[model samples]
Target: MSHNVLITGGSGYLGGDLLARMGAANLPPYRKLYASVRTAEQADGVRQYGAEPLFFNLKDESEIRTTVIDREITVVFYLIDAVQYEPPLFFIQALSEVKKATGRTVHFLHTTGAKLFSSHADAPTDRPLLDTDPQLYEIQKSQNPKLNVAREGVRTNCAVVEQAEKYGVRGYVFVPCIVYGKSKGFGEPVSTLRQIYMIVRAAKTLGRVYRVDSARPEWPVCHIADNTAAYIELLRKILTDENPSHGKNGYYLASSGSIAWDDLYDAIAAALVKRGVIADGSVTLASEKNVEDMGTALGVPKEMVPVQLGGKCTLSARRAREELGWKPAYPAEHILEAADGEVEWVLEHLRD
Candidate 1:
């Protein structure tokens, strides 16, 4: 019996990368991969990988049940955002439809972010968050308003996991931090790579560079290829019922390593210098006034100015390695190189 998999958000950056990897691996012989997209063009793009693309909105219950029910969708890879101060009830409803259709024995892979866990200056150094740690719940309660929505997501995910266990469905969630790689569609503009591109582009023309403050924090980062590999490994384990890591049904953070904002900025500057886009790495950190000026220059919102200047948020992926046997092939520098290549390609084709 061939395994059938349905992936939501198939036209996004991560989905595009996952589809590309599936094409490369050629695993799950006779795999019937279904991708849901918003537009006909996006559906066509997904079909290039030999996967069936279905046009359906995540919010439509009837559409979900109609498309997913009666289908032997043994595994599901959900990559929709339900947190980050966004409304994600539609995703929950869709998942409910899948649960209702599959009778809970289906393998559900939910994607989340590592930001669910919080950190503070007073925390003990040796008390890093563990899978069994219960402190995260408290920290989640005290998060900023923008992150309060994540608490609901976490609660919903926990409920789903519990329901899956109760109904004999296998569930797993992966929480990644700052995924970056070559993008294929209209990707979100606030990604780190996009910020880097804007800064590098500005530096090239303005003869000055922008750098974020180093003292803020370090962000955990992962390469798209590496992240995709982890997802594939998880999918294979679930579809085959192999209990790759002893049937652990909880959240796993996916990150290669952590890098300071200043370090990342320097790397992007170096890439721009290598490409001759900028004469030298003589860019200065954008002051508050410079940020406003640059926002106007770039035609982006001034409120997003601080995002480029923000520091990293740290996360650990040791659990992903120990449990799923996953490891990132490319480190931070290599990931930046991959992103720079993407920018260079875009510039070459888009340049008049």
Candidate 2:
């Protein structure tokens, strides 16, 4: 494997999983794997996964060009906001340099969340959302009051996929739903699991469970390991498929199953009772309108509530499975199966 791989956000929840999974595979995936970290502290953490941590800043296009083009990096994995046109379209410029230097197709994996279609709806959609689903899109052009957002994430994601050819890169946007389960990599799983952690912690601290006033919303979910498996298989395809039919036109979504918000709340409530976190076994449903302040209502920290809480946020990884041969081993119905371990872990690793 002469492919040099560069993974941005290597110390993040998803990026850590990618590095750890690649390292644990039967055969080493990349001949040279560089894990790009924003800080020196994260660089040390990435080294544990056998990846040479490069303190690379996406804002620094010249350095990125040197890394991707000069170092001949064939695969670039963006676990964070690499799709954004801001920071001066750094990724496109970097890949353009690669194509100018070498005519080879530089595989770029950009991650975007299912929140693109997430809404404040009361019910989940009957079917999973496709990449091209217009009704489900967050941005609606024709409505009286258009659903145009100022800083839309899906906009950047779409731009990368639509403009990849012009920039000389094979772009694939990975859109995953609410991700859970134990992370395989060394870095702490922060962003995706923060809500659940807060819920569990707040319940235990307050001795009561909480739910929102909104109608039960469905949330698409995938385990961390299963999500990582999808990435691994996608990379394998990028490496082996010389002229794959999928080409640069594929947008991959990873979703094992969908769980209703009420059900998840019950599961957490049950887990709390079983774990002795909540006494008297009572659940308290909260109102979003009544309490503008989460701290006043539940004593939980104000870390912007995830849109998945709004419901109808379902997605299908069917495209990814069919195209990349991705088969998620984790069960969506059994996501709370890891609740026990997660509870203990979060309690022990609780940080402000």
Deviation from native of the Cα of residue 199 in model 1, angstroms: 4.0
lDDT of each: 0.60, 0.65
Q: Pick the candidate with the highest TM-score.
A: 2
Compared with the true structure, model 1 gives a TM-score of: 0.75
Q: Highest lDDT, which number?
A: 2
Q: lDDT (0-100) at residue 33 of candidate 1?
A: 85
Instruction: Write out the backbone clash pairs for model 1.
Output: 104-169, 209-283, 218-312, 219-312, 219-313
lDDT of 2 at 259: 80
lDDT of 1 by residue, 73-190 (tens): 6567877663422223333344455667655445666776654443321212243455434444344434543433445655555555555556555667677666666654333312
The superposed Cα distance between candidate 1 and the true structure at residue 55, in angstroms, equals 0.7
What would the per-residue lDDT of candidate 2 be over residues 1-352, giving only the tens digit for each residue?
7577888877778888788888665543557878888777888888887778886667777777777777888778888663356532566667767767777677777776666545532213455556545333333222121233313564565566656766767777777777776676667765534456766655665566666535676777888888888888778777765443232345677878788767767777777778776765655565553223445334433333333233366555676676667788888887677766666666666654
TM-score of each: 0.75, 0.84
